[model samples]
Target: MKGLLVFFFIFILIGPIVADVPVREEQFIYSIMAFNGRDYSRTFCGENSDTIYLIADQDNFITTSKTLVYYWPITGDWKTDTRSLNYSFEGTLELTEKRRESRIIYPERYTFYNVKGEYEQNWKVAMGDEADKAWQHYQGLIDEYWQATYQYEQAKMAFDLMVDELAMKITEMRNDGIDVTGLVEKLKRLGPPESPKPPDDYIVPPMPVQSAFILNLPRGEYNICFINEDSAVMESSEKRVVVFEKRRADGIGFEVIPGDKWTRPVESKRSSSVLYVNGTTDLYLRPFFQDEYNDLYYQRMIRNDAKGNPSLMNWVYIQQVPGGRIEVTKNNHTSAILVEEPFYVEQTKGSALGYKIVPFDPEGAHKDRDPSLIAFKIPITRETSLIKFELLDNSGLNMAGSSRQVRVIIKSRWQPILLVLCLLPLLVMTVVRMIRSRKYSL
Candidate 1:
């Protein structure tokens, strides 16, 4: 039967490539993390998991190893724990309120910034008291830019070996004919040897590790325990931490983005939701500083995930709220306010190409670029509106959970009469099958 239908289409295409292999196993977990104020975030723990979350005055890090753990059929979750089957356990975490946490050793800074046409970068850590004098002046400008890039690569390898021995002594003095024309105009004015200019904001920082465990405590519910290396108490390393605090600390939270989808940002966070949009283009909001919680106590304080949901409620975010102004309004009587601008996208020059955006002047046409989003441009007109927003602060006040609402829509000119009533039932079933094939061929 045609080779059994090509062996049943090669066993249904190798049965999903042999059910995508990966099953793994080995256990013992707790590798905790938690320093969010810009860093350490992880917190996984499954062996009949238990609470963990931190952030009540930052700094955290736990240990307990023995690895492997697989499964992950594409985020149906759980893979990536095999740190070469770790097995480390030699700790000292012990909290239960006897606080006293400190072990500082610092030096891992990184916070770049300059992204107008995308791909910027970020790492940040330098907090307070001028983070050790800006990490010793950024590690003395990264050791003087790596000793001026090793003396500019040994003066560009001795000026490319003296320009290849002056072009082989001007080609043996022009094959002895002698008219070198001033040694080929001194080898065309001895060119090529520039390079050495890197130190403008050099980075390379992070090194001085002893890895974290600095607690700073304050907001309650602890338990921790680890202590091994003989003082026993290790076994599954004990957990239950919690710490939280932020259920409502100057709310707000936006992020939005959308200049035709700048990497899908969208997160408004309740003033009773309603963000519909699509009145044409340009958006970019941002905002931040949030809080809320409870989704099973913030997913068991970040992870130990038995699927969360303790009467739902989430939020979190926290920072970015610089200067503000927003306002917007519209149907509740016009308004406007706005503020942080600088746009510039441009692009269309022919054949229906598109992108325009505009407004970015710095001192005239993006003088040194970098501005793409400290935004609030939102100009989507067509009609079906609503709008609304608010924010303020910078002495103007208002910013608590910064109002919301968007709705826009617009699209109807009788909406193409529902595409001609969906092509009128496929044009009346092809004119009643052409009048029943000419009335059954007469």
Candidate 2:
């Protein structure tokens, strides 16, 4: 009788497997945002904004091989500019039947845990089978993500470069009494560069130099040529060749003149710095560049007041903070101090939260350093603004161990989970009936 009972149990389990038809379903999401130049039209200079037409496409998608069955655009107002329009393009687009595949697995899984805090997913397939499928799916997803990201990033960089070039060209042209706006449009129409120059290339007409500026060169026996409009060359004077190395002010970008002097630097153990000022000219700052080694320095340009001009006794201020000491120095000259310890800051809306791992090891690499050093800024909203950071290990696994601190603070206004809750009883009844039907052989 015991053997018969075991046989019945095995048969019941196998029956469900035999009757099961592998139903499969899949969903994919692809998104991108690309914006180019805008175009506008105007009839008269009445400041009529109505005549302006802004033309730029954003958040567009295209499936080359498949015909879209259904798709709807989610149109909305621009978040940054209320006058501008925005299109989210977030709806799912179903492809035609011709694009449907013969076999598709349901892209879903259930999570379980043997330990109270451990999270694991159990798929319909065995361990190896699920892993292989997941690997393939994720690999494709990653490739798609990276390709889109690279293209968008390159386009953005190119646009920025073009803008900077245009700005520089406009400034130069305007200084020469030329119509800079007209030149700007002409450059835009010229578009990309061509080898050997186009047959009808629009060349910039040469303009005479109205103002000449000279740089203070080192004392040297030198041969210099200045080519003017008449191709006339003017050459040299015998200046003493004094070679005194200024060290190129190692890693400095710009120098401050007396006028742009900042306040004195403050000597402090904490993170703070101070500088004093005694000048009245424009302060120029530039980005510092170093060799292959990533050495960094801050450079300031100061313009000094001419003789008899009012002295800037307290115009400039500068400060520096290092670990625990706070040092203040005056007159636009100071040394940069390295930060020896991580700074602790409180979390606030729109402020980046800071953390540092304890028991410091200074020589460790970035990855080997304490996980606490990773910081995340809080995302702000008109509603609740909160920032959350998840600390993951080298294996992309969360380290919080289901702690209360990891909980999501904001409760979403729209609760789709409520629908699942409502249908729970129905799902339970159907599952119980299916089990009973197989067990009773009815």
Candidate 3:
């Protein structure tokens, strides 16, 4: 009985030894230079057999109906392509009631390249898997639209035109006696517009959303949020705020005076904590002062710190993983480190696609660094909060991209529970043994 109790205690103690990958820390990169709709980017890599990566989570993606126009350089005209094909997906978000925002995950990834516009006939099939699959799947679905009888004759005419175009191509191929298999192989050799080639490199840009959060953080206790929505529950808040002193290059020290410059912290009736709203909050927000710092200071600082290590301009958030290992990365950057307490490495995403991102507390958080960049992270605690973010170009004008609110939930310390469970069984076993010994002795 004692041994069984010991075994049970051991099992409970060691069962959680393995740690899980931080899903909240997970991020995606995007491009901003030339992007579609709203100018705010979303949608990572278009689903392709070559570049599409299957991840454990696709919840961030949303399928919306829309038309996508990609300019075919060969045609020298923008093609308005419609289908069930164009689906947009937002990364994740955490919106503060104060209306101030930063992004956790960038909703879009993009690429920009000069197209020479030269391709074989079969090039259309090689553009991307999603493009192809969507084409075929949608063709069948839309075929019904073309085949409609009676009152839907107008829509049918449009469908008939599409069929006629396809038939013309098929007839041309047949008249030429083009060996379908051999011709496909020849086209494969020639490849498509988006094929992997040198000189004209196709780039996938970094996606960083700009977002802000008004967490109901209380003093004396740290809160960790896996942010989704509804900040009333302490465990449901995803936004995290880190208090830091901003130091200017001139060595001037200033503190963020909360008021009209910023929103007054509202007290939470549920937890009696303070919360900030997204738009209404009278929070500290000073515009970028050009005379205060050099325009190149931010990237220069990163480059200096990186020391010729290929660091790029980006907003970075740091989080302490289990075992006190810290990982710092921009939502727009991609590199993984697992070895040291605080590890640093350099990585690259798409081209130099510019974005407009505005800092919430420009005076508080934006002084020391480049006014164009902002960074924050959620601290670990037994609570949750919602976080929303968006990314824009340096102008801070247009929304380059945005993330949906990510719910961050902090977990309680398991040490106490582990101790109690460990000891309770031992105590029970001891009592049982004592009672059994008395009976045996009798």
Q: What is the lDDT of every predicted structure here? A: 0.68, 0.28, 0.30
Q: List the residue pairs that clash in candidate 1.
A: 66-87, 252-401
| Residue 393 of model 2, lDDT score | 38
Q: Among these predicted structures, which one has the highest lDDT?
A: 1
Which stretch of 10 consecutive residues in model 1 shows the poorest summed lDDT?
111-120
Give the Cα-based TM-score of candidate 2 against the true structure. Answer: 0.17
RMSD (CA, Å), candidate 3 to true, equals 28.6
* Residue-by-residue lDDT tens digits, candidate 2, 1-442: 9999999999999897885432221111111111111111111101111111111121111111111111112321111211222222221122112233322111122111111112111111112344355445545555666776677677767866887888888998789988877868866775433222112211221111111111122322222222323444222111111111121221211122221122321221111111222222222221121111101100001100012222221111111111121121111243222122331222334555432223234465433444322112211232322212222333544332111111113556768889888999999999999999999995
Model 1 scores a C-alpha lDDT of 0.68
Per-model TM against the reference: 0.31, 0.17, 0.16
Across residues 71-109, which tens digit of lDDT does each residue of candidate 1 receive?
A: 677666665466567776655666665355633222222
User: Compared with the true structure, what per-residue lDDT tens digits does model 3 show for residues 331-391?
Assistant: 3343232221111112234685332223334356444443321222222122324433322
The most accurate candidate by TM-score is 1
Winner on lDDT between 2 and 3 is 3
Model 3 segments more than 4 A misplaced: 1-370, 374-417
Whole-model lDDT for model 2 versus the true structure?
0.28
